[model samples]
Target: MKNTILLLTLLFSVNAFADHSTSKFVWSGKCLNSNCTRSEIEAENKANYQKHLQHIQDLDAEQEEEDREWSRQHDEDQARADALPKYQYKPIPETDNCVTRFYEKASSIIGDNAKEYIDVEEIKSGKCIFGFKLMAEEMCEYFDSFSSMATPDWSEAEWCRYRSELREVYIQYSGLVGTSAFTDAVQAERKAKLKPVEDKHHKIYQNLYEQHLKQLKQ
Candidate 1:
């Protein structure tokens, strides 16, 4: 009877061991260590939670720094753009000047008269003036007539420009076919025609140039 009781006691003890070993402990709502007690599992979970919270805080700090750097760069770019210079255009303004008066007088003297200056070759080849000496004489007369149209009221600049254009034509036909007499006669006529008013108007325009510059500044 004592031997049977001992056998029953041994079987009961083994069954209790099996039940204790098989029982599970859950951590963070999931099954965890089989060997760990409840207190040890809770301590491990608290440490894990703290580490996860620290990682999240570190990520947030990094993101905040990046945002601050981006904002600083954007503000610098805007300030640079604002610092650049700006420009605008304006039209030329008209003035009541002596130059205007000269133009007005010149327009009346130079109308739709297209054939103002005579062509030397046209006169020579067309049997109008046959020989070289006769053609040269006719050319000189034509130059004189063209020059007489300019009045004493014209500016020095206008006169100089006209004289330069006429001198270029004289150069083209200087001396090949007995044209020296013609060019010399043309020069003498031009000097006589211009000398009287040129002395007066030349200084006037020079002074006017300075006056116009002052007006522009104002």
Candidate 2:
């Protein structure tokens, strides 16, 4: 009887040890085996939390760098804008005596029928003819001066106005010569005679105009 009781007690002790060794417990609402400890689960949760925090920090740092870069670019653009030239209207001076005389004579001839009816020889020998020649020479000198400038002082509007003035001078000269009433063939001949001078001035004007546009972009 004593041997049997000892045997029964040993079996009960072994069963309790087996049950304890193989037992599962709840962690984070899920059952985990004995190997998966509460401390290990807590450590894993802490690691994940740290990883999340690091990710947020990295994103913040990237955003801050982008913002800084954007601000730097904006400042640079503003600086460029500030450094660019400001536009002011400057009128071309009408200081040439020859050009002034030509304008006066041409205006008078246009208004006076008797002056218009005068012989072509008389017209050719008049002050208007001499003034036109002087005006043409002055225009050529102006073109040379404009071409020699590294940066023209005139604004685009002033440049364009000067071009218009030159056109008006030619128109007035044509009227003075009575070419406006000439046959198409005679007009063509007159244009052909003036072509070389016109082309030379036109080339200079085009180069300066291109430079003006380039500076504006800058």
Cα shift from native, residue 127, model 1 (Å)? 34
**How much does candidate 1 score in TM-score?**
0.29
lDDT of 1: 0.47
Per-residue lDDT of candidate 1, residues 91-112 (tens digit):
7765534333323443355442
After the best TM-score superposition of candidate 2, give how far the Cα of residue 65 lies from its true spot, in angstroms: 0.5
Off by over 4 Å in 1: 1-34, 87-218
Cα lDDT, all candidates = 0.47, 0.48
Query: What is candidate 2's TM-score against the reference?
Result: 0.29
Candidate 2 lowest-lDDT run of ten = 114-123
Write out the backbone clash pairs for model 2. none
Task: State the weakest 10-residue window (summed lDDT) of model 1.
Answer: 123-132
